[model samples]
Target: MKEKIKIGMIGLGGRGMGLLRLVILNMSDVEVVALCDRYEDRQTKAADKVEEKQGSRPFVTIDYQEVLSIDEIDAVIISTSWADHIDIAIASMEAGKYVATEVGGAYSVQECWRLVEAYERTKIPCMILENCCYGRDELMVLNMVKQGLFGEIVHCAGGYQHDLRDEIAYGYENRHYRLDNYINRNCENYPTHEIGPIARILDINRGNRMVSLVSMASKAKGMKEYIKNEKSHDSELAKLDFMQGDIVTTIIKCAHGETITITLDTTLPRYYSRGFTVRGTKGMYTEENQSVYIDGSHDHYQSWNKNWGNAEEFREKYEHPIWSKFLEEGVQGGHGGADWLVLADFFESVKKGTQTPLDVYDMASWMCISTLSEDSIAMGGHPIAIPDFTNGKWITRQ
Candidate 1:
């Protein structure tokens, strides 16, 4: 493996552009040698950023085939639309390049299986770039679970709670994909943002798997209400009926008897948060209040005594090694610097020819929640069984 990894980036949307900037500025071991996007302006802008940092412009093309044909490109980052994620990942692996894909749930169970089969056949790493797994607080919570501080994890809760009314309403002008998804989908459209961190703490696809799940969605009134009240009353979207619900909650049952709950709370009026919550036999933690409680521990008793535990102290003591290192070396970029850490880890793993933190099974398990939830919701919250993407290999994956 070379010390420097050559890469190509596809789709220059907000998420993709943000990641591209992080790679250019923070990932010293990565060189983005090719840029591909349907939009010429986005591709040119990304190339300018690369050239500004590396003193040389990379190959730019509107066609992704040109990117895959580059002999120097060792990996490709697929940040395209949600529908294109699986197809691009499969193609990248078939072309003998490692793949890193943006966060989105799978549209179909067959697509998830296709990704698993492609990775198994090609033996190339395909990572679903879920940045929340590397979040500072999330990693600390995971370390706490690993260290048995949270004895016998029982349940975990997370959600993508944000207000995206304007973003989705005007998406047609910007070619954003969420508008169409929100207009047509009736299930959990985005699950990775919340489920990724919870899956890591639970060791999903290692010794445990999400056996089944059920989902329920409220009526889709937020977008229409926003279009009528916020936008012009005569706007087209005001009369348009959206299939997605304002709040979609999914309850997942793990094979080990633990349960997890994930919520999709976008398209409504709310503050921004993933709302990561972890509960166990011994203690619990909630991200919304930045609080933690442990049974019989000083923090637990102290909270009873003084109305709150010293969350700052707990964080200082239990910060993950990755965040500790990032803090020492200057934290920068998206999601309070988790983006930089995840991208750097990806490059380092590729350079060393090692498995990524988020492997194909993990990706399949996390992503399949979307389609399964759709099935469950359509059946009026009937429990839908999650497919075992590993096909019994999960028993020994650890």
Candidate 2:
């Protein structure tokens, strides 16, 4: 822990580059030791970014294996495609390095169990870096729930409603052709962002585990066609799948009897939306206007008390010294500066030999869809089992 955590970057794509920039700019506790990407331009550009910020460059390579086998790296960040998550995480964990993966845990049940086993056997820290939990509105929602403002949160709804049709089509035109379709196909396919904060609020896997989930999906929408077939038709992805417009709605029952309704929809073309309409026995919370209705007294309280609970304004009034220290001097990059905090926490936790912000079990619970979604889809929307991370050892492991 005395030495800076030697880190490696596996993908230098948009999200990958975002994380890299954050890590290089904000973290003194970690040093990026390697950079990798399929494209030669991305690799060179990212390495230059690191060198620009830190006055030193990391070992740059096109081969992922070179990154995995590098002796100087202590941890790796997998920010690549959804399909490669399981393999990359498994390989990194087996190599005895802590892995902080972007999202979507394993794609199948066996892979989920394999990840759990790998971490358990190695005793190494592996986590999903879901940045939504770090958002200000989400944090306020968690604080309110913890304070019992939403007494017995009965039902909550969360999902990603961003319109990626434009970005998907024109984004890596000259480089990869099939990228957008691969990303756009699944529903709530990347649920960690939408589900993470809500799970923390509900104490998922901490107090209640996601017991079962049922899902249903809508037909394909042509984001690729919007780009490939329309304006950007002359672009490289002229024949991409672009994805069918889909809305995969999932209902998750937590062990403690609370139910969370999760939905995944992209390609339908919408204004960007990711907020919950939370209902509880005593009160309810709405993201529509950032208001909280109470059980007993007071007019409807708007979390917007500071900056309208707008993440921007929250920072102005957010006075916690520890968090303030992070917000002040640190450089801002991704997701309104939350990404920087994620890296800082990981490095800090490694220094203390404690768990990162979201532990492996917490990650598994939020990301269970990597296995559960397809099963529910295949079974015609039947309930599917979620694995217990405690491994039936809550009574024993404790």
Candidate 3:
């Protein structure tokens, strides 16, 4: 029988709570041991839910270090703010705990470097929980690419675009930091979700890494408008430091001659879209308008629907037998229930003492865009270099 992986959770905020709920509901092979939150109120509230789910009260604390003090913990689920992810991740890694960080992983380049160093130094796993990688449509696209069905996928475009100012002005309790995260950084600052899964399908950093990125932005329209019409007092608006109406665009180059475009906009109207397009040597597969195009012999192309990224049908026709053996793993969830899928992978990897499919190197590759884009934006759209966290060893190590 496989050993149960004891989990310690840090930051019981909204997203953290959602993931906690997911683990309680979906992951049967794990045990929730510790829960931490800086806000006492949130800690108390979430503890009740945690007790209800686990049928036993967890070791709860307002101090994160207290959660880390649990020597019995085998791993930790970090759902802290973007700014805090790196610090907690490194600390947990140093503490001999497998660390799974919330999306976007780290905020700064230095923090990313630290995360890689911690993994290399400790040999314990560090993962960026880019749940989108497990999403059904995303995974189906990846499976097709791997089968050489889509041929040599060349170019891809994706993003995490949304209107977040409302969440800032009047969204939810405990949303101040999250709302601030949106307006402070360029829109595409968080691009891992839309890119991670597709890139995996195409085997990007697995073979080649992004070399450079050039980021540019437009005016900040939404911020300016909101401030202009805020309230009768308007004092709060004047005090805020904002450059509204900006649309950040980042163009990336992969060493394998593939290119990707990422766009970010929060000072505008909102709609979130994730793209799946594989322009291969013989044909094209797209998640756009819900269709796939296969090259034809005589100017007439074969179009496919329900074949491109149909998670249900793809699951039925999946060529990978391993995905089937783990069928009961990710029962019901989003990203084709990828959150559960990847977590399942983590558990299995831990049990077998094997390398995680998305390893430390994958974490670095996955996080490069946001880090570089920030620099590119800081330099007024100057090109920035991506540090090969693999230390000159380009592709897979060990």
Candidate 4:
């Protein structure tokens, strides 16, 4: 392991800069060696931030390939647009650098497979930086599930239910990538936020795999309505029609006979919530209510509302060990400290040459949800088989 793990940060967009400012630069044992973005302004801004923090300007480039070419960079943190994640991750792996890609759905199952193949060919670790996987509530629920509290987990449900209307409508003005996606594609565009933790609970791509999924999309009215009501009559966005549905619901059946339901509810009016929920024979956890209900412990039919916010009571006993240490060390960074934890995990794995918690197979399977949902919705909610990226290795993988 190097004395200090060196990093190349690609895609200096809002997300990229936020991760750099909040997490990577705050770490004592990591160094930012290079930064890349298509826009020179973004690259320059990121370089300036690095210089202010580390007292040295990082090598900046408009082309991501330049970041990958740096032989001394131990790993690359890819926070690029959704469409660019797979390509850059593959390139980073091929260049013999560890990869940590931001959360986004995949464009195609073929590309997802290609990502897996790249990791296999190079033997370089590739991790999806799905911070939600390290979420406090998520880890607590995962620990409960592992300890047999959620016995024989039968069903899990979650959603990316955020109102992204303004973000999508102003994408051109803000230089964001979502507007183009809304204009051209309609599927569950973002799935990993909720699904990442659920997959860990169910052991997807480990002990089980998602076999098939059926998706149905509602009418695409959110963005258009937002533009008409909020934007100027002559705004260019008013001339555009969004193809992405206001709400996309997907039902996935796992090979272990467990079922998972994920919804993409962006492009609508709603407060943020992942709507993480887990159900098992013995108990259940619902994020909306911030509650846990054990069959025998709580009154099932009556006093359901009384049990709301009860998950907090179990925190001391059931909190995951990772979060326990995080609390002791003081939680830091964005998204309720999940961003710091996930980045720390990735860097630690890079330094130790160890397998990341979220490996290439996990990334491929979780990301393929978007492309598969697109196919399913195109076929009028027909079920599509999710490719087993683990190539049947999931049957015995632990």
lDDT of each: 0.87, 0.70, 0.69, 0.92
Please identify model 1 stretches exceeding 4 Å from their true place. 298-309
Q: What's model 1's lDDT at 355?
A: 88
Worst 10 residues of 1 by lDDT: 300-309
Best-to-worst TM-score order: 4, 1, 3, 2
Which segments of model 4 are wrong by more than 4 Å?
none
TM-score of each: 0.96, 0.85, 0.87, 0.98
| Clash list (residue pairs), candidate 4 | none
Tens digit of per-residue lDDT, candidate 4, span 35-89: 9998989988899989999999999888889988988999999998999999999
Ranking of all candidate structures by their lDDT, best first: 4, 1, 2, 3
Highest lDDT against the true fold, candidate: 4
The reply for model 3, stretches above 4 Å from the true place, is 171-173, 226-235, 238-245, 297-330, 334-336, 396-398
- For every candidate in turn, the CA RMSD to the true structure comes to 1.7, 3.9, 3.4, 1.0
* Model 1 lDDT per residue over 1-398, tens place: 77898999999988889988865455777887899999989988988888998888989999898899998899999999999999999999999998899988889999999999999999999998888998888999998899888799999999989898998888888899999999888888889989889888887888888899999999888988888877775467777899999999999999889999999988888999888989989988888777778788645333353534345667777888988888998998788887887887887789998888899898888998999999998999999999999898777778
Give the C-alpha miss distance for residue 378 in model 4, angstroms.
0.6
Provide the global lDDT of candidate 1 against the true structure: 0.87
Total backbone collisions, model 2: 8
- Which model scores highest in TM-score? 4
What is the C-alpha lDDT profile of model 3 across 69-111, one tens digit per residue?
Answer: 8898888888877778778888998888887887763467777
